[model samples]
Target: MRALVAAAIGLAAAFALILAVTAVGAPSGETSPEPLLTTVPGPKK
Candidate 1:
């Protein structure tokens, strides 16, 4: 059906857009040595 074709096209376009953005925003080879999460201080006894 026409609606099915339109939906498929829309999905394809969206997927392509996502791929383009991800490629543009791809990370460099560098990485941080420390973990991203920090331990919260616990209440003192």
Candidate 2:
């Protein structure tokens, strides 16, 4: 019973850590790159 509880706690902590890392490491997009230019033509100048 004690081992099971410990394992559950450890799993929860690991899950939380993964979420925190993902949140922190994720790009906030404030410095996002500009869109690529395509070969398609647009309206005449």
Candidate 3:
């Protein structure tokens, strides 16, 4: 259990680090135009 927890944390940290690096290293002009978060309303049943 301890090992599993440690692995999960490690993976999460690595993912966060990767995202940070990508965001920081990317050129401003090349950024995506789309929003990072989006929601769509569901049709009523």
The candidate that wins on TM-score is 1
Which stretch of 10 consecutive residues in model 3 shows the poorest summed lDDT?
Answer: 26-35
TM-score of 2: 0.55
Evaluate model 1: give its TM-score: 0.56
User: lDDT per model, in order?
Assistant: 0.92, 0.89, 0.89
Residue pairs with colliding backbones in model 3 are none
lDDT of 2 by residue, 1-45 (tens): 999999999999999999999888976567548876787868999
Off by over 4 Å in 1: 26-45
Q: Residue 37, candidate 3: how far off, in angstroms?
A: 47
In lDDT terms, which candidate is top?
1
Question: Could you give candidate 3's per-residue lDDT for residues 1-45 as a string of tens digits?
Answer: 999999999999999999999888956577688778676858889
Candidate 1's residue-wise lDDT over 1-45, tens digit each?
A: 999999999999999999999889966798889788688869899
